[model samples]
Target: MRAAGIPQGTLAAGQERSAGIEAPRGMEEDSGRVKISDIRVKHIDRELDPPFDAAWDPVPRTSFEATLVFVETDTGLTGVGSGDTMAGFAAHAHHFIGEDPLRMVRHVETIESINFHAGRFWPLEVALWDIVGQACGQSVATLFGGTAERLPVYASCGDLKSPDARAESAIALRAEGFRAMKIRIDPRRADEGVAAVRAVRDAVGSDLDIMVDLNQAWRPAGDITRSIDVPAARLIAERLLELDVLWLEEPLKGDDRQGLVDLRRSTGMRVAGGEMAQTFADSLALLQADAYDVYQSDVVLAAGMHRSRQLAELARMRNRSFTPHTWSNGIGLLANLHVAAGVGAGPYLEYPYDPPGWTPERRDFMLAEPLRIDGDGCLPVPQAPGLGIVLDPELR
Candidate 1:
């Protein structure tokens, strides 16, 4: 079915790029007339040097895996995306075999349905955006209605470091031009988490804004779970507030809507979460419950740019802060960056930077060039067409 409001010929048919390139299986001479000819998924695994400590995970993470997706049009203009493994999309590929890439309204409906029966099809939606941008000859950020080419950034760390070590890291992050940094809280030991935040505050000396993440989103399988009761979360928030943490993230279970709201109200601290929410409807529920002061939803994991844009607007309408949680990988980060830039009014963006394990070099291994922050501690939204990422064959 066609998406309503996208008039025929709106995506005019013709060559989007330099002419004379050989077309693939399903091409028409009109560039706007494109079809999904093929789709492929790849898996990349890399071993960490010192086994990173995933704060929320039950076990130490010694390695990391990336799931890359490629969606090709009949004209041979391909778009790339990365996110959670598309476990069973191969079997359901028939649903989008010859579909229009720009009909995002229809595509979003298709994705929501596909996710219910088989795999999480959100990443495919990202690929669709990539294709649409290329076809329209504009950057994804521009497509999302953003004018700024750069967005403010904050360093985000995943490993659990000792107080002294974290202090050193915070100092270094400041030197790297970051105005802010986020500390991962050890779910197993709340005291250690509190101490780590205190150390960073002492080291930074009130120069850097610190956000603490409790990572109460998801846990690994077979791990003994620690329930963070309302009182427990309250006590921790009190301690972090004393240390002057700017925000507390995911202190309680993500679905505990009332509890999250209560934590924000009682502590008077900015509470952030919603990166794990599955749909815009789910986010609406969180908003209706006043669950957080800040809403962070990843486009790749949540519903894709179309839904994320709506969420961004909703957050603005509610007078709450909105930023994307971008820890997945470089591609995932780029997707959110465009959305955040498109939404505008964002004060900062998450820049995953846990050295020796989750560095930008490792996170962006597949990209032709790794994304880096400028002297102003901001990443310029890529101006290139599509997702603006070129795949590195060596890394693949």
Candidate 2:
């Protein structure tokens, strides 16, 4: 039942347990320990604003931003991580400020205890992993025992008004060297989604790989009224398959494990989800149910580097693709980059590449040097120790 390198056991050894249990082998020693030195959280706000426009979901939006969390070890090495929701970051500061950064597994559990009380402690966990990797003089990927440095990247476009517009954007992204692209589909109408796929496929031709994300996995209901379940998801999937989509992401509610399994079997398109899955148990359950072909673990949501890596390992063992979701911001993208790099080759890295909305400058405003896509569509595995990134002093 233990997924992601976490040891599952009862809180107590039980009354019948004998003294000769022998302290669980490695538990007897606290060797090679490193303590947490400092914790810094930055709330970043971007200058450039972008709109979120799609035929189905037309909501006004501006700025691509996120919260950057840094966990430093006593040895002066630091690790960087990011998250989307920064609502309760202050409350969890005490839980991470003085613990052993190297004991990522222990650190994640301690934070989980605090999470039960206040909720959402994954981002802080990510920062600790960065700290641990730096303390050990390795990239987060190498820390997880992954062999490869570079992984194939796919452009994750945000939103566009028309199918033609989306196609144009895809063409531009392809020119920049992306071999694969994932376009956002109109969740309201199946035909609009179909048109978007057709236009992009025609624009990129049959040679380029494409994926479509429904973003319909979870819809926030503004009122007390029940959330509307869109029946058009199935139809959209059918059309996408005809257009030769590599995969369909978040086609239905994420909690619908049976539905996802059935959808994958029914359509034969790789069903992908798990970006918002908040814990190891949630991911384990999904994997056990055979809910998805690709497991999209987000560093911001998986609660940190240790848990994320653990999820990646689980996915690898199951022969499932582990691609960390990178939509929060630049730091979130970089954090996942380390995790993806560590996962080795095969899975395509998610690169949030919708220009005017998620451009490199606005997305990575805090970093001294933004992580850029190479001419061949691959992002270089950061060579510097730890996360291989530093905050821009100007942003400080």
Candidate 3:
């Protein structure tokens, strides 16, 4: 379960693995004084051979794209983050070029401001935290409070499949050490989706915790099609209720506060969503309205690590689960992972995996090698300085 920066020795549960690891060699004694020297962006694309047919997306995804953000310090320390495209960021890159890399609060605020006028470049904040962890000689998880060193992860399957196929996959994932798995259900194919869940339930019974994703939270770019209406979602949800699913994700629109409440109450299930809320206020509105039992806001996509910690804590205060949606690349997963482990985010984190089309190899194409889940189906937080992102040297 160890990644690049994990120590060689065995670590007791919840122990901080980066306790004594120093900053990289040649780094200054006073790494705290390091200033941001440069911020470089790298675009890497891996053409998918089989083409991923995710249930949420109509078109078969033929390739995977990763946008890598590197934050270099004057002290020769370079922390990396990968997530959304840094479009229009270069025009405003100078805002952070010469500033202190450890000024995480300031950088997060700046990125949010730029997000209003440019893009949601929260990965920059992730890069900054990576630098801050390195400067202080600690992993980001330790800096985020080190509540726990590991968190249970669920296999997040993307593609839509037949009942038998999905059931077979579920059994295999359970055998491979995954304690839970999330199955995506297309809004258009509601009946078949419920059938898939039933099949999985019949196959694994209580051996696996099942989660269902309706993917009605928000539509992707250029997707004009409206999501399923409330009645339709409720209909499908009623069917899934029989299978004893752990949680039902994105069963309604992000802004449909009343509808979400109705669904949760009517179905008597743990409703989850808020991953792609248009803004922070939107998530607050949903939370304030008591729309969800579980908050799946992604650290990278929804908000940077700092703000996401706020959301997770707030959700915890309300007795709501805070396992986030980590559909982005491996770095994005790590960013979310640190915060989840740091805050003791419950029950299960998302680990995207669907063989032949989507796998760890494609999700973590930026890393030198893919990160492996532990034997117990838990994802151990990286113990390395910074995010511990070791990019492939050949990726120019």
lDDT of each: 0.83, 0.73, 0.85
Error of 2 at 228 (Å): 7.2
TM-score of each: 0.89, 0.87, 0.90
1-396, model 1: which lDDT tens digit per residue? 333554455443662433333334543345567788988888887777778766666677777888888888898888888877888888888888787777777788888888877766777888888999899889988988865789988999988888889999999989989989999886568888788898999888889999999887555557657558788889999998898888988888889998887788888988998987877888889888989888898888876778888888888898988898898888999998988887883668999997865788888877878899998889888888888977787744
* Full-model lDDT, candidate 3: 0.85
Compared with the true structure, what per-residue lDDT tens digits does model 3 show for residues 1-396?
A: 554666566567766656566434433345557788999998889998888888777688899888888889899888888777888789989999878887677778788888888888988888888888888889999988898888889999998889999999999899889999999888788888889999999999999999999888778778877777778988887788788888999987778899999888887888998887646777788789999999877878887788878888889899998888899999999999998888888799899987856888898887888977999999888898877777777873
* Stretch of 10 with least lDDT, candidate 1: 15-24
lDDT of 2: 0.73
- Candidate 3 clashes: the total is 0
Q: Total clashing residue pairs per candidate?
A: 6, 5, 0
> Where is model 2 more than 4 Å wrong at Cα?
1-33, 50-58, 220-231
User: For model 1, what is the alpha-carbon lDDT of residue 10?
Assistant: 41
Candidate 3: list runs displaced more than 4 Å.
1-32
Off by over 4 Å in 1: 1-32
> For model 2, how does the per-residue alpha-carbon lDDT over 1-396 read when each residue is reduced to its tens digit?
223443456335543434334334463166456667777777777755446443223455555456777677776766767775656767667766666676566667777777667757677766776666666677777876666777779988876548888888888888889889888775665677679889988888875799888776655435232222434566677888888999888887778888888778877888888987867788889999999998887877654566767777788898887787887777778778877787663458898878766677766778887788888889878876777777898654
lDDT measured at residue 294 in model 1 versus the true structure, 0 to 100: 87
Ranking by TM-score: 3, 1, 2
